[model samples]
Target: MATYNKRGYKPKTQKEKEEVVETDSATAEVFSSLDEGANKTEEWVSENQNIILIVVGVLVAIALGSWAYQVFRVEPRAEEALVESAQANEYYLQAVNATGEQQDSLYNMALEDSNGKYGLIKIAENYSGTPSGNIANYQAGMAYLNLGGANYQNAIDYLTAYDGDGSILEAYAAGGIGDALVQVDQKADAVSYYLKAADIQSNEFTTPKYLLKAAQAALDTGDNSTAVSSLERIEEEYPDAPEASTAKVLLAQAQIAD
Candidate 1:
């Protein structure tokens, strides 16, 4: 007969004891797998310590090299460029303010200094990556344009080299190139550049002026549709501009042609 234990449950037989041992074995096997994974992770970390150190060392060297370059090289060059640019700007101002032959003389001086240390062309060539260098490009273009006739291609080249954004100078540079193209009898290209200038900064001052110029250029090229489009933009978006009246007249002519 089987013996009854507490709660009226019968005592375990030999088969029941074997079942209990099997369940305990399964639980132990799960824990053993977990322990094996942890041990493998620790072994991998210990084996790759030298490789990890080398990677960290390389990263530190790169950061320090960048810091050193900025402190020792870039800052000094920028300061030198600033000093030279101030002198060039003085010549530029004199040339712009003076009249006739005096203006031509000063513009020539600004392009090529006797000492060769300070001038628009010199600064632009010497410090090509600096802000002053970029401004020099714009200045050189203006000086050449002001000189007139002989330097029109030079004006276009330097104006095209200007890469600054969202500034009055940038808009002026594009417009200057457009003006040069007109002088060269490139009416279609002139229209494209004028539109580019108008859209680059899109302000009340420069935008309306260039848009009007674009309309005129397009009309010259027999592009009535483009003329109408640019004129419409000026009338709608910049009604207060001085060119708005001219734009209205051009728009009327363009519509008739279209």
Candidate 2:
């Protein structure tokens, strides 16, 4: 129950206490003098409570107005975006359902969903700035790759431009580049991207697969020494990975080849 002064950690002396009492008495006298000019808290509050209510109401209105405005602009745009994206997804699915050369029709449909709305390519081009557009690039890249595994160059191009926040998706893109390179006989390049994909560390399933692919690329390029090293890494680092079987087999093969 001890109060300290500003200068030191001690209570006020009697003189300071007396000074505080005098200050309170003087302040009381000043408040009394102002009583006749205004009804004080009671009158001021009564007179201005409606004004206060109106001010608060205006503030609430502003907050709600801002929220409504943002929703009006953002929601409709996002909805339109979803519509276009869904159409693209539908086209992709259609392509999946189709077989033989008829799949081109499905690809075109995806690009020109009966509504003449933005196709996947255009969605990728226009909304290239948005998350949806980035996904469009991913889908389009995959479509191209699937349609022409020989078009690995183009697949690598689009996959390179892809910007996904997901580590797994990014890893997939990297692996796609490796696959495309391998298709073109760029085994060394394939190994690089495959190694990068395997290093993504996003999921259990994809990492081992990529690591195996990297090791294989090394082997195919007559780098059995490096291939052996990579296989050993997968065996030791990802023993539980699905690629473990392949890694062991590759390790044995590399040892034999070496």
Candidate 3:
């Protein structure tokens, strides 16, 4: 029969006072549990910090040993592989300039061993952790692309594996993957990569170009709204970029279509 928020109401009897004390006792139990847990945590940390430091020191020493091994042992092996790969690199450069059977021979030489030197695959295999190995991946992927045998998926695989950080070349690499995906009839996936490339920090050379391609792909897929949005972003965010002049025009056309 009591209404809510009847603040002036009183308990019917004196024993009702104990009911408030019971609620207060429950709250105190919660606070006690929290204090108990905090003390346990502090004690555990105090007891184990020395052991933790020793473990960390041992881990640091092991990591240093691994680095030393790489510097002394692995790097020398990679250097040897680089020397062994020189003939293959030369043949690849030659293949770039050749045609007919001469080109075929150079291509073959680039892929196969000659005079005890390693082919591209061998250099990649032996020096996989080295910078030269990563470059070999690019070189090999390009060679495969030039040869009529490369599938677009293979191009994407190599391009996505690019580990270069914070450079316009990485953006270009991402765009290359997008292009390869487009070549394989995967325009939707290509658009994602193109957008990713466009989102990276860039200047007049790459950012707007990739964004335009992404917007065009969006339009082809009946995503006119998204296409317009991307074009508008290009016009707004990159007014000085080469594609921006065209982007402004394209954005106007998209709005007309809308």
Candidate 4:
């Protein structure tokens, strides 16, 4: 028997033919498994179509509702709060520059005006989540503080409610609370808040000022250690500050007391 050979063509052995048959069977099984899985998935989806649609609808509704709330409710309220608090802010600015009876009158107007406009107090209470409303809390607190006397507690309340989390105003609010606490004779609490104010933001103006206040408050509370430490920080870190000379004297006094 004679075999005719073709160019670049090899005949498969018995084992090779068996391997090819096995490979084809494996590929068919894989495709069959995939088809079965797809069919099961299709059946499952058909059975749960209502539940799936409900979940998707709920998610869409939640997203739309949140967007609507921000656009409609929150934005409008913020604008309204800004407008309402403008007159109060003007009064507060005037009070800051004025003296004696006029100052008191202007501060009172900032808190509550009889001119049919919402004052700082009302704006803070009504538009709580808005930026302007948050600012109104700080303004109202300062107004009460400037008014002095029994209004110190009201200052404390409003300042405590203020949310100036990440700004320099946070330090200012803390210092204002410390001031109010000092006026109310809560020396230890005042010391705590003064230190907090100094720690919140480390700037040339506020840092040394609050550190000096902290040192003074600590001295008043018989916390000679804190007084010395705070005074020393100001003397070392803020030598060029306006409070530096005062801090030096306080440091000397604190060391002598210690």
Which candidate number would show the highest lDDT if scored against the true structure?
4
> lDDT values of the candidates?
0.88, 0.79, 0.76, 0.90
Say which candidate scores most in TM-score.
4
Show pairs that collide, candidate 2.
none
* Candidate 1 structure quality by residue, lDDT tens digits, 46-133: 9998998999999999999999988988888888999878877888899999999999999988888656567899888888878888
Q: Indicate the TM-score of model 2.
A: 0.65
RMSD to the hidden true structure, all candidates = 6.8, 8.9, 10.9, 5.2
Clashes of 1: 0
Answer with 2 or 3, whichever has the higher lDDT: 2
Provide the clashing-pair count of each candidate structure. 0, 0, 0, 0
lDDT of 4 by residue, 81-175 (tens): 88888898899999989999999999999999558898888988998999988998999998999899889999999998999885788899999
Q: Candidate 3 at 49: error in angstroms?
A: 15
Candidate 1: the clashing residue pairs are none
Write down the TM-score of every candidate.
Answer: 0.81, 0.65, 0.64, 0.85
lDDT of 3 by residue, 35-119 (tens): 9999999999899999989999999999999999989988897787677777888989999899877876786678666787778
Model 4 misplaced regions, further than 4 Å: 1-40
Candidate 2 lDDT, tens digit per residue, 1-258? 224334454336887677667766998989887885567777888989999999999999999999997688656666667777987898888897888877877876775546767778888777655667777877777777777745566677778889865568899998988888888889998998888887776456787788788888999998898788878988887899878988998899999998
| Ranking 1 against 4 by TM-score, winner | 4
Q: Which residue pairs clash in candidate 4?
A: none
Cα lDDT, model 1, residue 95: 94
